[model samples]
Target: MKIIKYLLNSTCLLLIFSINPIRAQVTIGSDIEPRNGTILDIKQNSNTGHNPNAEGGLGLPRVRLVNPNTLTIDSDTEKSKYIGVTVYNTGNAGVPEGLYFWDGNTWRLSVSVSSYGNDGQFLKSDGKGSFDWSTFVMPDYKYHRPTQISVLKSANVKPESYSYQRLTDGGTGSFGGATPSAAFEYLYSDELNILSETANEKYLFIGIAATTRTKTINNNVPRTSYWQIVGIDIDLTDKNGLNVRTLQKNQRLYKTAGGSDLRSYVDLFTIVPITGVGKGSYTLKIKVYNVENTFSRNTGSEGGNFVTTETRFYDINLVDINFILYEDD
Candidate 1:
């Protein structure tokens, strides 16, 4: 009997030693071999076929995660060893239930829903796998009208002749000697208050329509009369009356003839971008000027000593004006 037992033990040892080493790849639930390059592959035991109706699924280990910043699953020193570990968090203390993974430093929730915002608010992402509630603001639009429109009546005045006399003895002749002085008359002015509630980049649109009338008469002597509308000047100022921007349009209207009565209309519209200027009071002023209005008689034979009777009149009339403010992107 001892001899038979020794032979059996030797046979068993030989059998064990002859077996192949353990395989590096493993599969669970299915009979098919583990896929290439996979350490462990798990699949549903679908006896029918590989379809969406597969019955069984993997149930990850479930645990109550108390905190995400600290290692509460195991020994603190072992956190680095289980870096890619994942589990189903049942929640504990103040933590919410979700799927979590240990990312070497802290446990991060794989999926989370925030309960911080009201019904009308929207969810905003932090670009780092976090979300919060925020209120969406709509664009703002405002309209303003001129508070005052001052119209100056027509006036008769004798302006200098548009001519330059050549100096004889190596002297310089006067340039633009007949140009009228810059006497701008304010046609419209308005004040707009930008409150803190309307906070955003904005655009300002100004619309203006004006009419001008001029009359020039020549008593023979073959003379020519000249008149011009030197465009509009738009000035924008802040609460402290400091000029912010100045826009000018030059040489809008020009007419020259011996004797004529003319009526002209002009429309000035512009858009200005408003930025950097915070909440404050602002003012918009529109002014008009005529830099040239003169008369000159023909020289030579027509320059005979003749009585010159001429009357020049000019006027500006404001038709309509509008100021609009709207938000921009």
Candidate 2:
């Protein structure tokens, strides 16, 4: 009876060992244990430079274990093969070196981007995860000033100059207030085609400006006059189709004082710097709204010749918007 019991007990122990049952606590290593859900675990006793990575140091792969694995070089086809592999892009003749990973469609990277702020603001480091946002005084670039811009000959036409013109005053009186003159539409846009070799929106549209002098002319209806900038408009276009920026309220230009106009001749043309110019063919033009007339205390109006004579040749400048050079990246 004792012999038979020993045989049965031994057989049961063998079966239990053969059919191993599953357990959740999968621990390894003699000293350390698994924390949780660890399918595989490894332990190293000492540190040594067993294998050097591409950097010639005992550094691990640029990224952790990735699906499909990294290829040694950049391959447009390999990207499709791997589908979801990540690798340190070892730059070649035409390729750039960077940390990138493949998704289903394209390789993505953690690219650094530019930060911007108001003129008086700058960047600061917090010695932590993020940069502290603020402003700093930039050293004056006191770089050489660029050469004066030359207006293209194509835009220097005569007939197209006075477009969208309309005298809204009902003679015998003068008035003020913006006339929603659809006149902007009448201005010739042929000059708009090529004021520059560059794209349209890239050019800054400083409105037309010229110095002027007032005189009590010997005429039946005597008056004095001056000039001021009015307003501007902008537009843009791209893959999405044509887009138009509706004109904003006209900006009023005020005289700060000084200067006498030379009779019989208009002052040299100047550019009245525009504030908010953007992308597209701006095709800037000057429109004199109110022709100022201070009468000789007696005559209420200056003959129409005053309006025609003064604004003879003041056209705005079209400077390229190359602000990207100074932009923070």
lDDT of 2 at 84: 57
C-alpha local distance difference test of each model: 0.59, 0.36
Residue-level lDDT of model 2, residues 97-140, one tens digit each, is 45566675555653432566567666664432134357665695
| Model 2: CA > 4 A from native | 1-150, 154-229, 232-243, 246-288, 291-329
Task: Give the Cα error of residue 311 in candidate 1, in Å.
Answer: 9.4
Best by lDDT: 1
- Candidate 1 segments whose C-alpha is farther than 4 A from its true place: 1-183, 196-199, 218-229, 254-260, 291-312
Poorest stretch of ten by lDDT in candidate 2: 320-329
Model 1, span 1-329: residue lDDT tens: 99999999999999998796875898786776767767886765533335653456779999887677676778888889989899888877655677889998888878565686798998786665456788899876554432333332223111221111211111222222233232334666677555433445666677777766643333332244344444678887987789877888755465544433455677877876665556677777776655443433323355321211212234566767776665433
Estimate the overall C-alpha local distance difference test score of candidate 1. 0.59
Q: What lDDT score is found at residue 64 in candidate 2?
A: 34
- Estimated TM-score for each candidate: 0.37, 0.25
Clashes of each: 0, 7
